[model samples]
Target: MSVQPTSAPTWHRLSPRMLAIHPIIELGRALPALVGVFFAGHAGGHGLLTSLAVAVAVVAVSITRWFTTRLRITDEQVQLRHGLLRRRTVATRRDRIRTVDVTAHLLHRVLGLSRVVVGTGTSDRKNESRIVLDGLTAVGAESLRRELLHRTPVAMTNQGSEPADELARLERSWIALAPFTLSGVVTGLLVWGFAWRVEGESGVDLLHSGPLRAVGHGLDAAPTALAVVVVGAAILVFVTVTSVIGYVLAFWNFRLVRHDGGAVQVTRGLLTTRATTIERRRLVGIELSRPLLLRAVGGARTLSIATGLRVGRGAEKGGEVLLPPAPVDRARAAAARVLNGATALTVDLVSHGLRARRRRYVRALSGGAVLVTAAGVGWQTGGSLWPVPVAVVLLATSVPLAADRAAALGHAHVDGALVTRSGSLIRRRVVLADHAVIGWTLHASLFQRRAGLSTLTATTAAGRQGYRVLDVETPVAIALADAVTPELLSQFRRRPAPAPRATMR
Candidate 1:
């Protein structure tokens, strides 16, 4: 008997607007090389020809890419086929979709187009397996996002009118808290790096640039204290301005919405807009962050500790962020709302006791003590008084830092969630749901054991994988683990030695 051939799968092409978008994107990506070429051409008197050739090449590649890319959605899976030299096909099950990100860069926005990224829980920094559709009309992208996430055929217009409850919205006043955040420092470093790159490429000495030379001379002519004050003030102003601009650009029109279809969506950004939708089922916990400077200014940020969402490194700007630097009270409120008003956010945490406090002090001061010893040695051998003052300053600061760390150490179990608070420089309170905890680990170093303390870690499949309750009393750690997961350790429980029989003599 002869078998009949099956019909070919329907493949949909990207938006025609991608023809315009891809060229711009490819050209921008090749800018550094274009810059180098421009400099070389200027010197060789072939500037016009070289630039034209490069632009033509970029456009050719862009057109080829647009022609090759296609995507399709079947009942069982979503498939994508793309690439010119190395033709490739990627597919993922409909149920495996964990996140749907809709992004529009400036050019995309201008052309009414968007890019859709579909992520499974399997992706990480090392290994990435994601399906990306580089170009789609804004309405098509939104409709696809809603269809994939909600598993329903929900056609949407360019501007969606789906009813969603607002969880949080960006406030203009929150910009004040931006200076207290590390964003300014990060922005300054990026700016410095870019300047360094430009100087290296152009063979220019930025430090000896005309304006810089004048500033350097002025500083040299001024008194030491005056120069210090002027430099400090200048740095402060730069940081403040950059921070404010960054805050506005990144979080403009930020809004957190909970859709009726059991998903939470976050929409933000100015020049490059992004909308990320995460299933409520994947949300296992929430994190409240208070860095030292941010804490001093009574500001904090909120992040989602959800499965499939990576929350580390640049997580503050990633899809996991729920709220940017805002008042601490507001942060807590957002955390609570995310947790569905779980008491873990507000419940008083159980202290780790005096032994734990001592451990904190010892750990914090060890570095200072070593520095002080080295300073003393330098004073004896090299007669350096500067080391002594530096060591003294460090030692003095360590005491208060140790105290603050001790104050921050605590954990509690409330409403079937384990709430853990730790750290000093970047204090974090992680409220993890009971179901999220797959296992428990108790660890003790030689010093920790000697001090009758152990670190209890709750392992999960969600963000960070493990959340630690640092330096709790040994018995408390064991009891806490047992309380959270009784069945896991029931067979391994230690039995008390049988009471000695009374002597009959």
Candidate 2:
């Protein structure tokens, strides 16, 4: 909804990035508008001067429309104003702001710009977005963030260099790669090889259906085996190239910026890059994942808290990613910062049966597959020692060790929070507001009920980190929730108590 200014309309700077995005506003519609103007001018064909005037009028209007649009960034609030005929100004204050994000495209790089989005509201923080500044340089965006944070008071910390009420920082970790792309390549190559092998088999020609009917019959339908081979090779090459590019783009230049206060900011991207903020208090949990191939490379998976956060409505998407791809130690340390727990101690939470089945066997299987494939390739090409298979085998050997390390990454009693680790391969460290939970829930599947495994879910006032918990005894999960609900509410009280300087051992 467009906000009505209370006192006065204050003008704000137009970040270069935001101005560049001005063109996007007229996207798709610009062509039609131009077409309409051309026809109207012809319809009103009169003296040469009148025709020239009409042309000039259209050009002037378009430029004015682009230039007149403005965004107002004030200490108290942010406002967006645009449109020649119908304009809107949406404003939200700082206290209500829950999430802030920076995103840039390749175009942004050339233009030296990025977009800032802030979101408000906890329950549905994802939807309440404001582009406080669509395009701003790195420095301007930071200054604007400080301005908004200063004018808008958050309960987490006051705008000062005072000792924090609770000292915490967010760290970043990433989920390992997805296996589909690689598997897809393997599938394509296998199919092509099969097609090549069977292109002239005795029964293969007999079973020809679509190709035979579409063209003619027999050899008439088939434009030589060479054409078939070339086409298949082209398609496979295209698919493989696109897949590789997508992977590189997805994880290009990933970085983590740790904050002194319990927060961390991460930025990564290839074409359209993204910047995310991980606030310690907003994180409810963490998740880890590893594909079969990634297991061979000793990589891990991670995903966490994007729940309950009513990012109090400001601009853009507010929640930080609970997922990323990172190594085990880094993931643990990141989680430590978020939980305000010790990085020194680690714990083991993996069930013995599941650990072997999920973590160990998979690693072995992936290693064996790569070794077999590499050996076959080595034989075909007359290899000198097949170094590829050796690497694969050794890398696979590290999977269990990484899982053991991440599992050892402990979650324990901190002064004001609960921290936990999940993932055998990709480790995710999660932090929860020990005293900020407003509701608690227990979830159990039929299998869980049978095995006495259930999960606990907790919700907080902020929109993010308001969702599910993992495996626990059903009854225990329920009791844990019930016991903690009242205790949490009471402990946080009207406001959070001062944060301890260091967690106790």
Candidate 3:
């Protein structure tokens, strides 16, 4: 859909509700500083008046910013002008736009408003490349999202495109996969660190508080090993509960759909609803990720390998995620649907030879030996000796891990697509289209050269740019490159002498 001005092109202000909510958003963003101010006031340093004044100033600045900001949509581009003392304007060409995502947090949803972000496929700095329109009516935001996503330079008067077919919707049964998908250990450590910080800052021992103290007392009479087991179990339970709640909140009511103009649309989240449109043309490949725990449960997640998607920007939810964690079969099905019948090319990958396997063992065992040696030396120097045994056990375990990793590493070309499988702990199978590959790089370390092995990286304009087929036989790497793009590497290949003397013989 392309939106045009009814009369002369004119600038528009944000929803008036922004005046009420913008300040609150600003304060929320500065919450940590505000908390520090309150702590200072409680400690008899900064007075209550100082905290109040600081908050008031922040709100005043937010109001000024709200009033100064204005947006306008013209025939060729979308423009935003803002700032009080230093006025600034940003504009993005409509044809260059790759994604338009709408997000509504709890407060914004309550106010019937949402935020719109329009981005072009190329900027290193997200803020610089994207235009954000905050606090627009939900309906208005949706309209803008569609208009930006579907607009073309030649068709300025086209009506909004019809909604595309839904490819997948949230399934209640899929929720069972949540606990497996969540990083329970990491979440538990974060929670522990946050509690410790609060205790340190407030000079209150949270562990010795009423409920915690009672729990501690209950475990004090148990054997040391039993107490450790009890505490570990408690932590595991806590982590699992938190992980489940978080997974549910983040992916509540998730839906994936195929939108017009070859775009894929995703709508998800609970407290903060988000609608994201990704241009299908930008998608170069799909990654099927299986973490250790998830793999144990036969679950996997799908992420699009595409250009214009920001990585590590939105908590753990990067822009590339196409499907949340689900059963491995279901994930593969979703990938096929998203790719419009392109099945996963992960079957029957060409394996590296014995030399590669030997190299993996050497690398893993050497690293493990270093750690074991360090631990042993530390123990001899009167440090805690417990880690020495642990290090020895880990070193012994690396043998199997190395074997598994070597067995898992493989690559193959099928139906104009290149498939690469690697990783043991967190397996990732990448399926990239051959045509998407722009170049190839061959690298050989000293050991690799002696072992007649090399790493071949397929370079592309989209996705991670470089995807490797690691530790393949040197001839195989060259053959793979030639098979993928013959003309590009043909000149570098030495042609065998034509069967010369057959006629003479």
State which candidate, 1 or 3, has the greater TM-score.
Answer: 1
Candidate 2 local accuracy as lDDT? 0.51
Candidate order (lDDT): 1, 3, 2
Best by TM-score: 1
Cα deviation of 278, candidate 3, in Å: 1.1
Model 3, CA-based lDDT: 0.80
What digit string (tens of lDDT, one per residue) describes model 2 on residues 224-272?
8866776688666766665455545655666655555544555667787
lDDT of 2 at 304: 41
Superposed by TM-score, candidate 1 places the C-alpha of residue 104 at a distance from the truth, in angstroms, of 1.4
Q: Deviation in angstroms for 275 in model 3?
A: 1.2
State the lDDT of candidate 3 residue by residue for 121-209, as single tens digits: 54223457788888678777777666666653323323455658788887888778777766566677777876666565556677888
Predicted candidate 1 versus true structure: per-residue lDDT over 439-499, tens digit per residue: 9889999999899889999998778889999999988888888877788889899889999
In order, what lDDT does every prediction score? 0.83, 0.51, 0.80
TM-score of each: 0.91, 0.53, 0.88
- For all predictions, the C-alpha RMSD in Å is 4.8, 15.0, 4.4
